[model samples]
Target: MLADLRLITVQEYHRMAEAGILDADERVELIDGYILKMAAKGTAHASAVTRTEQLLRQLLGNRALLRFQDPIRLNNYSEPEPDIAVVQIDPLDYADHHPTASEVYLVIEVADSSFQKGCGLKAKAYARSHIADYWVLDVAERKLHVFRSPSQDGYQTETVLREDATISPLQFPNAIAIIRDLLPKLRAE
Candidate 1:
């Protein structure tokens, strides 16, 4: 029943994806040296990601690069692909290797079936690596929980955001995203 039997490093995982060892059709991701079978994107999950992406792309413009479902190298053992990641401005950064946590400005995981995993496991991993910011987009709840100020344990700041709220990146001063516009079909009630 297990698709991946061998433990692979971050580098190896990328190489495998690069070499077509795993096809695009395979719904899977590498996390903490283990290949995890990701749940198929339900309707709600896909909608959230789509709306979020549109808002982010327009807000960030040319200042930051927007990546969707891309693998980010956390470390030797961990390289989990977040739903969306705003990375540093670089033209050739992803040419030879995946972006490290140091290169990431923010990571967003749109959680549907993997809500616990995103809020718990991935949050800890991002924090341990000193990731500047992380957001859990709760599809079921139609809200975003922002996490920032990484410490030895976890993120120092945590805030819940609704559709009417505005979100600004910790790394970028001028960039702002309106939560309501980002969730077009979401109802606050």
Candidate 2:
């Protein structure tokens, strides 16, 4: 007789991560029954995420919420750490529990080596959970890919934002961000 494999809950996954058992630089996510290592983010990816976070914090002020590279629980089946997430309000109330898709206003993934995974797998997960908006910061292509109108399948609306463009969150009608100003500054290090 064959027995079915046990699926780990989102809570269990967090306990392991919080215990500091995983390496500091490890890129990991709990998908299905296993803990998987995601593709290591490159410098461009890191810089782009940083720039976006800074800009978002400045523009939003204390009006909205912000989280950098935090785990978002899509459901019982998946929990992936997105690059940056902008929520409607401060989330300090939920201490250990991961923020569900309903808690998020927008999810941004700054992509370099993990572009495909971020754009594909993560997009689907966010969509299924009814996340209002999703953005993939394409560091290599130097573009911002916006995803909206999510369904069970995925986003029905997708667009690539160029340097001259400004992108705004659908949740906040008055808020807007300049793409050119938000892009990662080229630095020799």
Highest lDDT scorer? 1
Candidate 2 pairs with clashing backbones: none
What would the per-residue lDDT of candidate 2 be over residues 1-189, giving only the tens digit for each residue?
236777777777767768887766787887644677877767777778778888888878887778877787788878887888887564565585767778888898888777787778788878888987999888777788999999999889899999779888887766788886667775641
Candidate 2 weakest ten by summed lDDT: 87-96
Residues 1-189, model 1: lDDT tens digits: 466556788778768889999886888877767787887888888888898898888777888888899888888878888999999877795887788899999999988889888988788889988898999888777678999888768888889998678888888867788776555374543
TM-score of candidate 2 relative to the true fold? 0.85
Per-model RMSD to reference:
3.8, 3.3
Error of 2 at 18 (Å): 7.0
Native-referenced Cα lDDT, model 2: 0.80
Candidate 1 Cα errors over 4 Å, as ranges: 1-7, 12-24, 184-189
How big is the positional error of residue 171 in model 2, measured in Å on the Cα after superposition? Answer: 1.1
